[model samples]
Structures are given as C-alpha cells and as structure tokens.
Target: MNDYIIRATAGNGAIRAFAATTKNTVEKARSLHNTSPVATAALGRLLTAAAMMGIMLKGEKDLLTLQIRGDGPLQGMVVSADSNAKVKGYVFNPYVEVPDKYEGKLDVSAAIGHGNLSVIKDIGLKEPYSGQIELISGEIAEDLTYYFAKSEQTPSAIGLGVLIDTDITVMAAGGFIIQLMPDASDEIAEKLEEKINRTPYVTSLLDMGYTPEDILKLILGDFDIEINEKKEVEFYCNCTRERVEKALISLGKEELEKIIEEDKKAQLHCHFCNKEYNFTENDLKEILKNAL
Candidate 1:
C-alpha cells in the first residue's frame, strides 16, 4: 500500500490521534542509506513518527526535527520533517548491526543503547522551541511517549514498528500516536489507555493490510471518530547543487581559496539523501567570484 497519514479525533474531540503506514517510505530510506537490519528498524521508526508529527505544526513553513544520540552501534539518527509531510533523515551508522533479540524482532534497544531524544520545532520564531529528554528504551516508541508526558506535559501513547524482511528490506513500517486533550474526562482517558494497551503491534496490523484509518478505527472504535484529514507521506530531501554552491560561498573567500589551493576540488554529500555534489577547479573559481 502507498504510504499515508490520517489525523482523527475521538471522544468528542477530547482525544487526538494520528496514524501512518510508511512501508514505501522506509524502504526508500533503506535503499538510500543501505542500512543494516537493526539500523533500518531504528531509523524507520523515527522517520515514521516524524512524518506524523510534521503535520502537527500550525504553519506551512514550520519544521520539526527528531534526533536521537545513543551510545550503541547505531550511534545516532536524525529526522527532519516539514508541515507538508515531506520528511527525510539519516542514521549516523547506517551499516551498524546487532543480532536479533528474538526470532522475529530486531534488537533496536541494544543497537541504540542509552541516549537522549531531542525535539526541535521552528515556527519562524526568534528561537525555535526545543525539548530534550532521556531515552526511555531506545525503542523509539517508549522514548517518544516519555517525551510527550514529561517534556510536552501531554499524556500520550505512541507505538512504532518496522518489520524487516530476511533479505534486509523493509516488510512493514507504521505507527500510531494518541494524545489526551485537557477536556478529556477521566473515564475517557482511562478507557483509551486500556484499549491502546491491548491493541496488537501497529506494524503487525499494517502487515495484515490495515490502512492508517483502519488502525485508528480499531483503537477508537468505541468512541466517536471524526476523520480530520488525510495526507501522503514520503521520504524526501530538498537538497540541490544550487544549495551546495551557496554553502561553499558562505565559508568566505579565505576558506574557498584554501579549498582551491589544497584540495583542488570539493565533494559535498547530503546526509539526508546521500547525494553527492562535486565541484572542480573551475567550479570553485566560479563560486569564489560569486562570494566576492
């Protein structure tokens, strides 16, 4: 199924929910970075969550970034998303690997070890809003849940998963986020907590051909559901040769001259998409003129 995200409200708008199916998106990341199974699982989960969270911002130009820095083999991961649901990211160690914790599951926690999760939001503010929290489980989901409750002061339940095939490709990837608004009654919150705790793994449901709407329906079945919006999500990077040229100019004339004198050429790589841009002697001279 094509990747998409659905936003909905339940319990008479007292409960807000978001769910997404991101198999294609995750597969694209694996292909771009050539990530190992454990790295794929860790990065895929964060990318899925970032895609959903991207649309949470109120402005079109807003941006959200989710970054995890850990002590394990995976090292760290970063995901950036815009309000349009355009998301991209990279793992610090895409080739990192670890034995599966069990027959069917990748060892994401061990691959991430103990670490910190950082959330940064830029809404054209003088200073972007930032929140940092200790990683709870390095499993992505539990860490995000803790982030919401402690950092954002919102009670939330987040479940994220990525199923990697034996061939090291993504088989299924998806997640769900449910939050309690202030008007939520005690009974309503309690009921939702109970239901979410009992639901099957989100990726397992995706493997069964469940859409984001269906996943939300299963979780909010008893409560009245108001489907708010639907949007497509994908692995996207907005890097270009023009952007790279401007960056080289930003380094100032002295720096550009040193590059021309020492290296003779520059090869710049975009971490998000792993795209490389090469600038030769002539290209560096052209950029130097523009810098002046």
Candidate 2:
C-alpha cells in the first residue's frame, strides 16, 4: 500500500507501537484545501496522528476526532477518522502564513500558537468519550504526547513531520506513536525513550526511503517486535448529496421557507471535502415539503 499503518508490539506486550506513511493522504488534502506550507505541515501532522489513533478503536464504526483551537494565524484544525483508517480534516485558515523559526523548518508552533487539544472518541456507546488538554506545545506531535500522558494516562512518544517541496507540495508526511503499556518495565521505557531520542526525524527517515515497517524495526528492533496488523489509510470524507439534503432538512421548516423566499435556491458546502451541493428552487420546495 502506498499509504499505510503498521501496528506492532514488543517487550512481551509491554509496548504498543504504530507507524504510518501518509504522504499521499496528506497531498490529497493539500490539493483540496490549497493550504499554505505552514498550514500544510500542521494539518498533515494532525492527520497522520489521527489515522494512527483511529486504528486503535476496536469497533468498525468507532470514530475519532482531533481538534485544535488556537489563537494564532492558523486559527484551528479539525480532523476526524474511523477505525478503518479513513480520515478527513480541515484548517480554519489554510492560507495563514508565518515566518520560519529557523532557516528551513516550518514554525508549526507559531502557526498554531496557544491552543486546546480535544480528543473525542465516539465508540458504540450512548455518549462519546472526550478529553481536553492545554497544548504543551503547538507542534502537533508534542501536544498529542501530552494528551496521551495527561488524558489517557499512557506514556507515549509521538513524532510527526511534513516536508514541503519547493513548489509547495507535500514531499513526505508520516509519524510514529509509541506507548508504554501498563505492564512495561522502567528499563524498557527508558530504552525506548533513548532510542527515540537517537532516531532521526520521521520525515527525514521517510525521505531516506524508509517504510513504516522499517521505522518500527529501527526503533524497537531489539524488543522482540511482532507485527499484528497493517492497513491502508486515506483522506476520505463520507459526505453525500443525500446527507447534505438531510442537513438542509434539519435547518427547520421556517428557516427553509425563509431561505427559499430570499434566495430562490440553496447551496450547501461540506467542510470536510469542500464539496458544494446546490438545490434549485424546485429542489428546495420539495425538501421543504419533507421538513420536520
């Protein structure tokens, strides 16, 4: 698979690890959103993390959403994923630009500024699980590491990166999520941390022709690592015209009447995919007839 995730365990199940290569998935999002380089990096990082986290869900229909609401130029981002690794997301200000912190690196922290990261998981339950954390760092990876440690009480190391080409297209994008399972020993955890500290940036490894499997091997090669599952992930949105029609219907009879009277037609846009659904006057009238 071109873009895929690998799930593995090591240290006799004392550690759980997930690695993914999401260049194509992120490129599709860049083309769809026309995101600037900084915006692309930030969104790509979150999308990659979301894909890995989504796969952690047990149920086929389980959903995960990662949202960052910040005070910087890139106002916020919202990414949603399913257990099967289908993910979609959007940035509030795709064109927002910021100066690089260094000569080459994109300043994702500046783009995101201070923010709150919210993780919402909708499993097959009456109410979805939600957790919120003040972002320790606006860099998507660190914030998520903090999220895992604080909210889930799982010590995790997350590394995410997005490399932008000269022409403003995605060159490489991917990440790894390493967690210390409850049974993990201090020696194993320390060794894993040391390995991560010595490891190169995920994008650098990916650009050097490393696959997800290779990444895990490099990080946990000595831990008796065993691969459990592998799955392809994509930038997918499940929005349809029928679903859009249902949304319009939910706008209420009076609201639909007002829209019909004023505009003579209606146009709705899907935030996740930038798809526009248009309804002519007749279409609006027909929809109004079915309004609740």
Please, what is the TM-score per model? 0.98, 0.98
Native-referenced Cα lDDT, model 1: 0.93
How many angstroms is residue 16 displaced in model 1 relative to the true structure, after the best TM-score fit? 0.5
The per-model lDDT (C-alpha) reads 0.93, 0.94
Q: Per-residue lDDT for 87-158 in model 1, tens only?
A: 999999999878889887889999999999999999999999999999989999999999999988899989
lDDT of 2 by residue, 1-292 (tens): 4899999999999999999999999999999999999999999999999999999999999999999999999999999999999999999999999999898799999999998999999998999999999988899899999999999999998989899999999999999999999989999999989998999988789779788899999999999999999999999999999999999988899999999999999989999889899999999999999774
Off by over 4 Å in 1: none
Clashing pairs in 1: none
Give the Cα error of residue 268 in candidate 2, in Å.
0.7
Model 2 alpha-carbon miss at residue 105, Å: 0.6
Which residue pairs overlap in candidate 2's backbone?
none
What RMSD does each model have against the real structure? 0.8, 0.9
